[model samples]
Target: MFRILNNSDTFITIGREYVLEKYDKKREEWLHIPLKANIGFQADGMIIDSGSETSFFASFDTFNYNFPKGDYRIIKVLSSEGDGILLYDDFKIDK
Candidate 1:
């Protein structure tokens, strides 16, 4: 789950855009992990009013893919055409 806060003075637009990346300890860099298939479509636009917030549930299934255990993050794309604000949070896979 993730919460998006709109603290600005004007309305903000958001979409269901994101990419998954894994941290390479050896290289000290993040590498993009391409999805086996398109999980979903991008939203035309979802608006959040000023000083408001919205929460959404997100899940990444690694059952089919052989993803190694390590640190990872979801690069949340907040605009269209892969250009705009980006928000991310880190997570770890112990299993």
Candidate 2:
């Protein structure tokens, strides 16, 4: 789970992806999936500030369909500019 609060006056757009780790009796591997809507595949990818500090919530429930019970990590990539800094990398989902 991620709660982003844009304290700045302007809106920000951030690109996101999930680095999921799936484990079985054999081995474990990672999978990357882009964060987008299931129906449209459109990237709205922007956060709008509503005068006051705007709060945005993001989660990766989509992986439930493809991945079985395991461990996972979500990484938020700031792809707008400069080195693509990783914003968040602590999110772990387990089942």
Best candidate according to lDDT: 1
Off by over 4 Å in 2: 5-12, 16-28, 33-41, 47-67, 88-95
Superpose all Cα atoms of candidate 1 onto the true structure and report the RMSD in Å to 1 decimal.
Answer: 3.3
Model 1 stretches astray by more than 4 angstroms: 38-40, 62-64, 79-83
Q: Whole-model Cα lDDT per candidate?
A: 0.75, 0.47
TM-score per prediction, in order, is: 0.77, 0.42
Candidate 1 lDDT score at position 32 = 87
Worst 10 residues of 1 by lDDT: 57-66
The per-residue C-alpha lDDT of model 1 at residue 31 equals: 89
Worst 10 residues of 2 by lDDT: 16-25
Tens-place lDDT digits, model 1, residues 38-84 = 45645676877889988766656622356689998877766433447
Clashing pairs in 1: none
